[model samples]
Target: MSSTKDIDALIDLMAKLPGLGPRSARRAVLHLIRKRSLLLIPLADTLQAVAETARECLNCGNVGTTDICDICTSEKRANGELCVVEDVADLWAMERSGVFKGRYHVLGGTLSALDAVGPQELRIPRLLDRVPSEGITEVILALNATIDGQTTAHYIADNLEGQVRLTSLAQGVPIGGELDYLDDGTITAAMRARKSF
Candidate 1:
């Protein structure tokens, strides 16, 4: 007997998404309903399709509709370098930068003692296996600038020390950052990694 019951339920469900709160979700649902023919129906169909097919790539842990992602199967990406990221979102970020030409390896998460997450829980073992098999020459750690991220990076570095060259993204001031706004840790890293002009 409630005409707005299904709409309210839809708003409730949309509000559960990462960044959307109840207000945003209600606005979004209203927009979708207004554009039902052009957006809502197609969006529903696409969501259903993705829900049925989306899966993690077996080799690199990238999310895709196939067992392996397109990047893993691309011949042009066979440059002997592998960028290690903490999640699929990081992998996508690196790709968006368009600077890293080599492939990527996604560790499901960082190694956390409190969470009981270890190398095995991530893609560390798979990464080690891929080094020799895939002829990897260098590994670039592109993890976050967090304590757990550094710990995971160090663990990977220790394991792959002599087997391949190891590198990490520089942790310093952003390109447009002013020194006064930067933290002490960022300033120190920028000083330590200072290069010739």
Candidate 2:
């Protein structure tokens, strides 16, 4: 029977977001309440808009406001090279470095036997479909370095074998590292030193 039940609910919802815990969510909610006009209102509006309009890109599995993401529709990005990642966060990390010039294919997640996630569960079939249609010459597997990530990468490489040149980011990356967690410089170096797998 807290007087601030609505605010507490807001904190609970925010805490569910990745990287934000209960303490952080409470602080954030308090800050938003204090700055309602400057931050809270705007954030609420934007969240509402995104909730209504955000969707997966039909072509590349990217999260966007349209059926096809901007990268997939951009002619300049169609360079015969496709970088495959486990999530949209990894794709955004790669884009942050401004190193990759080609298009991207987001696998949504890695194959996990324990989780029972297979190629069909993810966007693998769509990836295979895109390769031939888009005239892709190379596919760079930019997945994380975990066991599940490696397993997924091997699967994709096997499926795409003989169709295009397959490569992976170089090994300056630590074991179990996720692309989204790597610094921009590290991502740049790894991408630059990518080799055939």
Best by lDDT: 1
Predicted structure 2: lDDT: 0.93
Against the true structure, what is each candidate's TM-score?
Answer: 0.94, 0.84
Taking the tens digit of each residue's C-alpha lDDT, what string does model 2 give over 1-197?
Answer: 25387987898899999999999998898899999999999999999999999999999988999999999999999999999999999999999999999999999999999999999999999999999999999999999978999999999999999999999987656679998899987788778877899
Worst 10 residues of 1 by lDDT: 1-10
Worst 10 residues of 2 by lDDT: 1-10
lDDT, candidate 1, 13-110, per-residue tens: 99999999999998899899999999999999999999999999999999999999999999999899999999999999899889999999999999
For candidate 1, the per-residue lDDT at 22 reads 91
State each model's C-alpha RMSD to the native: 1.6, 5.8
Supply candidate 1's per-residue lDDT for 154.
Answer: 97
On a 0 to 100 scale, what is the lDDT of residue 77 in model 2?
Answer: 96
